[model samples]
Target: MELEVRNLSVSRGGVPVLEGLSFRLAPGRALILRGPNGIGKTTLLRTVAGLQPPLSGEVGLDREAMAYAAHADGIKATLTVAENLSFWAQVFGTGDITPAIDGFALDELRNRPAGGLSAGQKRRLGLARLLVTGRPVWVLDEPTVSLDVDAVAMFGAAVRRHLATGGMALIATHIDLGLDEAEVMDVGPFKAKPPKVEDFDEVFL
Candidate 1:
């Protein structure tokens, strides 16, 4: 499978942040997004995930084939670790969560309440949810946040396995996650230029 974007423009709060962005990612590969803060990396990923509309152009891919992981962990504090995974497994119509649990080394904490897990553990749990989705395309936002070195390694291993199985990922991260063959896309050049002086003044006047 391949994801193609044609001259896509994305915005937040009706203000454009990225423009003229286009790229195609084939299966068994990963594309890393790089840029300074507020340069629209998250906005681009969100738009691609269909969480928000792109200001222009198109995203060519099957929505059903993509799984999106936002910046937040999306965990239920009251539930146990295994329970949280179970809930998502059911939502994604997957029955076996063994791989997700093993992939993240979450077996020991399986019975613990999510509320009690440390920040890194919670992050791992959130990432593990992705495995159970069974979708081929993963769109992730800063997936390594709060993860320790070992956890990051585990995450990298998981991503490698996904690619090995012919899946692809589009990741936005500040630090390296050791994706050897992943292509890097610097979003800097695609940042939307500021409005003209008169146009900017007109909005406030």
Candidate 2:
């Protein structure tokens, strides 16, 4: 099923950041979110991922249909590369970590402990988790943070593959991922206005 976001309003730290935002992501398509720093891109992604509630509107997809990858690697430091993928594979009930290992070039480091890997390696492992998820929609926030040029290309390819398989992606990143078919959305127009002084006074009245 396609992912639909209807007139969504999201907040950060209990203060509104964006409002009246709507978008739809069809199967085999990708949408990229753009805005200056602190523009609530992360907040909006979190809301759509069901990590946090939106102030208003609705995210049409359920948590099980989407996989979220944020800045943190989200790997178990004690687990080996293969083990980490296996764990997520089990959690998502999608057997076989082979594709994930091969997708991010993790075969060479499969036996290595996550704690000992370099930052870029760790990021690759984290991104690999998305493959094992078997979810239709990927909600990623700065997914290429620690990736090098080659690693970035690997990620771009993986995203393309996902889309080709009828999966969708909602990504927030400044880097050019080289996905020419992806649509871009700027959050500037949806920035929430500050509450009027009288609105605050009404709270205590």
Top of the candidates by lDDT: 2
lDDT of each: 0.94, 0.95
Clashes of 1: 0
lDDT tens readout by residue for model 1, 1-205: 6999899999999889999999999989999999999999999999999888889999998678889998798999999999999999999999789999999999999999999999999999999999999999999999999999999999999999999999999999999999979999999999898756767668887
lDDT of 2 at 117: 96
Give per-residue CA lDDT, model 2, range 1-205, as digits (tens).
Answer: 9999999999999899999999999999999999999999999999999999999999998987989999996899899999999999999999899999999999999999899999999999999999999999999999999799999999999999999999999999999999999999999889999856767668687
Q: After superposition, how far is residue 26 of candidate 2 from its true place, in Å?
A: 0.7
Q: What RMSD, rounded to one decimal, does every model reach?
A: 1.5, 1.3
lDDT of 1 at 158: 97
Candidate 2 displacement at residue 83 in angstroms: 1.0
